[model samples]
Target: MTTTADPPQPDDAGAPETDPPAPPAGAEDPATSFTRQRATRWLEPHLLLRMSLRAVVSAILGEYNDKRELMGEIEADGFLDLSTPDGDLWIDYVADLGDGFAATYAVATLLSRPELEVAPQGGTTHSTRQGRLLVLGGDECYPAAHVDEYENRLVGPYRAALPRKDPDAPCLQAVPGNHDWYDGLTAFMRTFCQGRWIGGWRSRQARSYFATKLSAGWWLWGVDIQFDTYLDEAQLSYFRRIAEELRPGDAVLLCTGKPSWVAATDDDVEAYATLDFFEREVIHPRHARVRLALTGDRHHYSRYGASDGAQKITAGGGGAFLSATHHLPETIHVPPPRSRARSKSRSTTYQRCDVYPEAGDSRRLSRGILRLPFATPTFAALLGGVYALLTLAVGAALRDPAHGLVEDVHAMAAALRGADVGRLAGGLADSVAAFLLCAVVIGGAVAFTRDASRRRGRITGLVHGLLHLTLLIVVIRGATWLTAGMPGTWSLALVVPLVFAVGGILAAELVALYLLVVDRLFGINSNELFAGQAIPDRRNFLRLRLQPDGTLTVYPIGVRRVPRDWDLRPGWVPGDRERFAPVDGIVAPFLIEEPIPIPRTAPGTAA
Candidate 1:
């Protein structure tokens, strides 16, 4: 009986006699479940409110000129490198016109390399040793029709990097961007047209929109997309006539500022849809050798194809401010389709494509080789990180030994002692002055940090601003210390407090700005105001709502009126009643109880 009882007593190594009860379905442990639900409920509305406020602030402050000084400095330094391995082929320049206005310009002789060869589909590659290079795109600067501006911004760069044009090279052909129409293509036609001279007459110059054939068998058709609208009746007729005249082996290279089906505004998209008209009426009917379209307004490179085998290539980043980031569509149609393989930075690099004839196959497609400097966001982030780390390390290493870290502390104390003091009262006054100076330095730093975090649009901007503000405070404090003439040596105690005070002031200012401008004006309700998480959409309209049950609902406002064409839509409206689960997982009504006021003050107004 004793042995049996001992055996029945549970042994440490044996399995438990009974298993713990399983958690109920859709339920978690009390501590963990409560924490998760709390987090989700708190974060959802807060983020939305914060983003709405940021957008409103950006819209209001966008017109301010707070960075005029910075702009001037950038302009003076010419903030870009325009050199190539071959030599300086382009002069990139930025001009500050004062009051926050600036213009960027670049010039380069973009000549096709004669020695380069292009291989056609189904044919052996052949070299074009000395063929004339044609200017496939820009021949003149637009909008700023002033001869001086054009000469400085456009002609100068090309002349500086002027490639030796082969005497027997083909005459350059050209297309015009939106800017060309600002002056009605007058200057462009005067510079490039070889036929009837248009002279100073605007109407005659505008006639440059007319089409002309560059070679006998190969037709270079120029189409003027006015405001990125569809081709006019005359242009369409001209294209049709040219299509009819094209022989079986002849190729038509179409030039325009805007590609036929690339992303653009509704009006522009509608206009380019007319390319379909061309494809059905002319391209497919003729079944020509090669139908190539080239454009440059995007300021980036891309290749697309129409269903009828029409190839479209965008070579817009020709020494201009690079286009915004682009994403390739899922269903792009090209003869030999290519997809975007990598992400890239906003760059000013230019691309050069070399085309050559293949030896064996006459029915082969043309080969294109693109040359441009590659860039990536990762590279930029790495460079910025290195710079920041180096700065911090250098600053830390350069501290004064007497003060434990700060070199100027002792000198500052000494300066305070040397101040002219006729009596005990005067000496006290000098001491007080020294203390106030320290306070100012501290206050400035706090203000800077607070402002910086609130204005966190770009990481680089935040880092640069914080570093600069801190340095300013440091220099000011050091100068004040030197002038005061006191007797005490530098001490870590004093230095630490001073640095802390400065940082605190900066942070406070930023917080204050966020609360006053961002939160109040933009209706940002975060955990600070309402105990919940926040969600924000930077590109949409503002929206925020506090719920009856203590939770807040925040999102973009004005949904019904949001154009169907818009890529994104804000979630809320004034009268509509709907419920939405915010990013933080809090569910609340979509519409807010009250309307938020939009400030008329421009962006950077506070700055």
Candidate 2:
């Protein structure tokens, strides 16, 4: 295998090389360290409701205001162009970050460093300098895109990491993801479109999408495919103009928000189809080859290299909750068989080359789903509340409300212990309100299925709902029996809390079991499965070097664990090493694999 070996690491006088100096001693140490935050607990009750509401409102509002179309009217002319004054250049790329502080800052801290010495497998240690250009692949901030969310989650962490201005700061550019589209690109535009400063990095792009000319014959194209929608007319026209600058045999680096190649492998062809159409209509017409495609929506690192040495990589592990990699396809055919006739792009089979966390580790981490209650306490609490309501409804249906509380409990317990199905049915039939409540609970369970859009998903959801209903009946009966000998009003107190606490856990476990079953049987709900676990480790990013000889070397960096505590640097000023330092010391990054080298010309190219 070819490798980009690190050059010798010594000055002419034989002095050992080192990264730039740490923050100056004059910098003050605040009374407290910045408390690190965890990855977004997506299964949390309040967050879920809020996100769902935003998604719905955004969808409805988006119909009237297409941000991409509006972008055309305001976009600046000409593509972003970069020169290689030193005959070589470095670029940093990360995506799917800004969910939590600790993980996001961990990655940011690394990126902000002037240089990193990484120990690659089977190779000598080497120092890689920071990129001159920083490309945020997508999903810059998580949960949703809002002014406050961007500041706290995305900008704040980055500002804290770098925390100072520089004369030669890297240029920042981005492509919007679904989360950024939650606010209909309002927050995204504010953050990236203004050519402002985000930390020491300066934003240069004036639109959600960008095309950059890197070096003599290489280009970086960042497309904004809003919510996996079509290539809007305005965006396409912009790229078409950029295409005019392309020369035959030139190479392009395509950056997109989603790994449409992976989606195509999963039988979702439309996503890749959009990308295919863009390449066929825009890039190919110029006779330029897309040497590599990069993306970051999957929250892990996966690379698929075609026979011609062209590569597609997904490096989403900037932050956010770690997504499972066990389910990724081993190989995929670009332009998938169905969409071939629509484009002149030739078909190529790309095989999965390297993956972070390894498939075995991914499978092992998945078992974390079994700890659902602890992983997502709010979710369990929501279930507990549901169970409490169901129990009260059962009590009202079986016992006389006119009686005292203790007497009612005794009567309800007696009816439940008797296991008299006919009497139970008669009581339920007589109480219209109680019956309706039961119907709603069951209906909710069925509706909660992640894959509810498909028949199997509906069936799985119905099974999950019935399982919760059964657990409710068992918990009510068990709780009443346990409190049988308690004093007056004591059983009432013990029973409700027990149902709420214990019942909630049991119901959540059922959800975990449901996720496991569905994933194993039908290959669905993997997102929900790992989102509940919210693993904070296994984050990664890419550093690419463009040599004057037209050779591109890619370094895949991985962080197995992010620091949880940070020491704040007060009174820090520009040119300072960093504003906050990790308490456990900065985690040294390692190469997930050897640096991949893609030549300017590969097999079956325009040349």
Candidate 3:
């Protein structure tokens, strides 16, 4: 093998210097920079070898698995035109997917319609044939920003959508979600820059939360509530500045990842803690002429009112995991002079607002009305009833052979034989006991069926069902033991009860398993499965039963398949239908001008 000689080094004289003076032996080479050293250390043989092997394997196998993803800056081309013919703006609140994968999906959906227009509500608002879209929250990749991850997860999907850039297309504004700061915003800055390096501005790498003037008078402010913590001094000052800049008729849209109030169960402490923080730090200040405060991360849709006359809208339903059904509390603040209170629940929906320069009638202008469904309580009750009945039936069938139906019959026959007077007397008592036991079973079944028909939730139905099943098993076993011929020893008497207990346990287990499957895999509550068919097409209306207090107690109607045009008047007493809102414009509040008696029957008129 032949080796090439090293290149000659030039000295101060511009000639090759032989035997140049050597520096301190321990000193590092002056040619090596800190960056080079750091890079070398990071890419040491052990680390590089491991990463390289994994990468090669992934490449060969066509698998690009990595937790950290870098969704590159979404180019202007990937967005669809949402500008209305008259040019109304389309604002989308999206969040919770790391690496921008989910955000890209939501953006694509909005862009799919090209006929949409973008218009400004405040200032010299103009309507564009192109639809303008604004992203409310969650624009960063999750966990950490790895360049390759962003490319594959975020950029790839966005490119696939091929968003268009309309000369009048709505401007895009974004707020940083919690994941953006995982690695100190390094990846976010690089990816959002679109291959251009952004210089440091105000100690932030140009990409940290900034506002853009979308329209002449409307200022859209995006705030980054870093790591779920309260706004820092810098961020608070920034918001104040933005607020001060707002004009009287201007619309201010504040965007964040977390909602001010979350719907949660009584047992969930974490959610309540968050709610407390939001109330004190954010909602209390009543800052800005907030047209809308949009948020995500709850994976549901909800709208609440702020004291500032702003609507706090949660738009977290962007095709991620659905959240729990939320129920609004009685104490929840409702806007004064409202005809009806709004329900609080996590819903999957997108909102459209039509704001016209406060022209003519303010009400007619339709200020940011949200069109979404409230999860009906009727459905919950129906599910509860169905699950209870099915589980009870299954439990009965699985009863141990030794203690169930067969044993009861055998004991009854023994008592009737009258072979021995003492035995006959004992058998007679046993027979009566058995009869009462069966009655208990019957009672349980009746309670369960009645509660279920009334459409109680799973918790109530479950209690009734389990009680009935247990009572039924116990009664059957007791009858069997009483009717059987007297055993000489106590040990033999124990057998019958043991058999019954074993059978009952088995039945209970099966019922529990069935319920688990219904809840987890199918998202069906057991009550609904066993309950009778749900009321059809009346999702928006709550079926109320009259109470002594002269108030209406609303019940949910679970059925979605019922025709919207169907009349419930046949079931309603005469004149009851007149009290309800007319079918057209049913969204208006029900005005009770006088005391109207509750209709005993369903409404005869079509709703």
Give lDDT tens digits, candidate 1, residues 1-607. Answer: 0111001111222323433232222231111111111011211224335544644543333223222112122111111111123321110111110000011111121122223232323344433222122333542452233444454444333322222222222333346555444444444544443221111101111233433332323444556665454555555554565566555544455566665454422112243454444554665567543345566654334444433334455544333332222122333322111223132111111122211111111011101000000112232232233323322222233323354433454433433333322321232223444334334434533432322235442332344344534443443344335434433453333433444444334333333333333333333311122111111110111111222221212121111111111111145332211111123222111211122211111122220
Q: How far is candidate 3 from the true structure (C-alpha RMSD, Å)?
A: 23.5
Candidate 3 lDDT over residue span 310-407, tens digit each: 45555543322323222222223221222122322222122222111111222221111111001222322333333333322332333233465656
Per-residue lDDT tens digits for candidate 2, residues 519-588, read: 8777788898888888878999999999887778899999988877777666665446566767875676
Q: Whole-model lDDT, candidate 1?
A: 0.31
Q: Give the TM-score of candidate 2.
A: 0.89
lDDT of each: 0.31, 0.79, 0.34
For TM-score, the strongest prediction is 2
Off by over 4 Å in 3: 1-92, 97-107, 116-130, 139-145, 163-170, 193-205, 214-217, 248-250, 263-287, 306-309, 326-607
